[model samples]
Target chain A: GAGVSQSPSNKVTEKGKDVELRCDPISGHTALYWYRQSLGQGLEFLIYFQGNSAPDKSGLPSDRFSAERTGGSVSTLTIQRTQQEDSAVYLCASRAIQGASKAKNIQYFGAGTRLSVL
Target chain B: EDKVVQSPLSLVVHEGDTVTLNCSYEVTNFRSLLWYKQEKKAPTFLFMLTSSGIEKKSGRLSSILDKKELSSILNITATQTGDSAIYLCSQIQGAQKLVFGQGTRLTINP
Candidate 1:
């Protein structure tokens, strides 16, 4: 509604089980980003979508990580055959680029989904 | 590759102590540098700096960006326990992506 929102605040899944996390960005905001933070580590950029197209997926750690955005609003990040090392907090952020304001690039972040692969 | 570097990855200080966090970017065509304070899971935005040498201040927190050095600094005066959190520095890179540093973890003891 007023800010970026994410789903499945906490998820505990067995190894090899696929998990899907969702993100709903601020309304009418065009740019969306997904990042992963391992324990005691900085955020690692996973992928970003600019109007349903991901121009840079270079940060995806491996083939097991995939993401997609539909309708340029809601985005989904999926992990295939998850492993223990895949456990981390997945954060989603959104920013508005429709205006010429200097703050247009400021990203509003979600509470994030904490995934634990057991 | 565009990346941000932060110094003093971890710091512990008593209340009322002043501290300065550093951030440097290695991004080409850098648009802006932003500072965020992350508490728990969500990170709250603090400041966005585009022009050099202009300091943005909010209460006990202040930040300055230097375009010539490709660096920025976040200064906190009269720190309190509530100010303890992960301070993140991000650079606006190509395609509107935010290139973030490893983050500086500051802990303030009461």
Candidate 2:
């Protein structure tokens, strides 16, 4: 695709249900990020993936939140045991992974998936 | 701990008015400061300021970074209704780390 793409622009699930959100980054991008934004709040970084190395999961809120990047192109964010508080727009962004370069860090974002947990 | 703070949690202004938004941060090994405008969904990048005293401009929006003060300001002139949105500021600490501020909600009435 010409730009970053995300699936299921909107999702609704009940508590205790597990949900998966997919992201297809721009071609050749090596860095992918997952962020969550609640109502009237800033983005909460969930995880970061660079190539096939271990993802930086420091920002994930809990164990229920997990993500994986496959083949260095597509990624998926999974949320288990959904709660009402989990309702928010999950955004995905991708950027080139060049070390110490200013242009490398510019992230292009997707439209995001609006997840509603009942 | 790293933190980003934005002032004027919310503001109301009329069209044609000019406004300035503030963002302050405390982060170690600060790589750069980023500005984004968020509306209904994902946020769109606005500016990335890496050096102090250098101003970045895009249309009516301009931003300047102050490395010494650990702050940045976004200025908009002759605002329009379309300019209404949540303006967010984030501090890039290191590889794959961006700490975001709570954001400033700007409402420009037509």
Candidate 3:
């Protein structure tokens, strides 16, 4: 793909329901990230996956929020027992991990999935 | 805790007017500062500053970083109505994660 792609641009789920968001990063990119953006709020880092290393889940708000990246290409973010506060936009981004070039550190973002838990 | 703060949460200006947005940060192992412009969806990357005192320019948008002050400024010259959007500032930490500011909403009226 030319850029990062996300599935289900919009999702409306009931409280306590589980929701999964998927992301397809650009070809050959080795680093991927997931973030959450609430209404009128900045992007909050959720998890980061680099190659086959263990993901950095330091930013996950709770145990309900879990994510997995398969084959270092596609990634999935699953929110279990969603609450009203979980209503936000979930964004995915990917970056090339190469030399020290500045562009390598730049992240390409997907359109994001807007999750609304009623 | 890593922190990024942006000033003037919101601003309104007439077309052709220039506007400057400010961002300050305090984070460990800061590797770069990035500026992004967001419309309805995800934010698009604008400029990434790694060196202090060097200005990065793109068309009407320009940004400069000052590591000594731990701050950066984005200047938009002769803004247009299409430039109306939210400007976000983020700090890259440990070359892995990004810590972002609350963002500045700029509205340019015709």
Candidate 4:
């Protein structure tokens, strides 16, 4: 793949409705990241995956927010009982990592999914 | 080493104006720096500067890094309305992830 791909470019859900966002990383990309951006705000890190393993999950905003990556390729971010505050753009990015220092390598981003909870 | 700051949180200018965006990092061990332009949802890559005093350019967009001052600046010449976007800067913190700064919102009026 030439770049990262995200599904459901725009989603509008009722408050308390469950929402699932998907991300498909570039071929052979070992590192994947998820971020959230509210209106007029900077990107906030949510969670990241390294070969299907998330070393840190503290970035998750709350218990309702959870993410999983299977087969180290596609990832899904699930928001349960979504609130109005969850209405924001969810961005996904991926980077090809080989050696140790490559973990901070350049990341290719996908056209983010705008999640709107009303 | 997660501190990254960008100046001029927001700026508005007419077309053909030249603008400079600044970014400073306090990372003890700096490896690489990156600049990105966010138009809509996706942020397109602009430049990556690792060496001090060396300028990286693409079209009318150029950027330079200063290690001693722990800062970097992005210069866009003859800005167009299409150049209206949020410019982001990030520092590579080891091999874990990127430490990004609060982006500078640039708006170019036609």
Q: For every candidate, what is the interface RMSD in angstroms?
A: 1.0, 1.3, 1.1, 2.0
Fnat, model by model in order, equals: 0.64, 0.57, 0.71, 0.26
Candidate 4 positional error at A6, Å: 0.7
lDDT of 2 by residue, A1-118 (tens): 7988998999999999999999999898898888888888888888888975545888789899988888998999999999999999999999887656766867878989999998
Candidate 1 residue-wise lDDT at B67: 78
Docking class of 2: medium
TM-score of each: 0.95, 0.94, 0.96, 0.91
Tens-place lDDT digits, model 2, residues B1-110? 58999988999999999999999989667778899998767688899988643589999999998888989999999999999999999988656567799999999999
For residues B3-103, write the lDDT of model 1, one tens digit per residue.
Answer: 79998899999999999999988866767888999989988999999864367998989999887798899999999999999999988777777778999
Candidate 3 local lDDT, residue B65: 90
Error of 2 at A42 (Å): 0.4
> Residue A28: error of model 1 in Å?
1.3
User: Candidate 1 residues A6-81, lDDT tens each?
Assistant: 9999999999999999999999988999999899888888898998999989889999999999998999999999
Q: CA lDDT of A17 in candidate 1?
A: 98
A best-first ranking of the candidates according to their DockQ comes to 3, 1, 2, 4
What lDDT score is found at residue B10 in candidate 2? 99
The candidate maximizing DockQ is 3
TM-score (chain B) for model 1?
0.94
lDDT of 3 by residue, A1-118 (tens): 8999999999999999999999999999999999999999999998899975545888899999998888989998999999999999999999998866887879889999999999
Q: What DockQ results do all the predictions give, each relative to the true complex?
A: 0.76, 0.69, 0.78, 0.48
List candidate 4 stretches off by more than 4 Å.
Answer: A99-104, B51-54
| Off by more than 4 A, model 3 | none
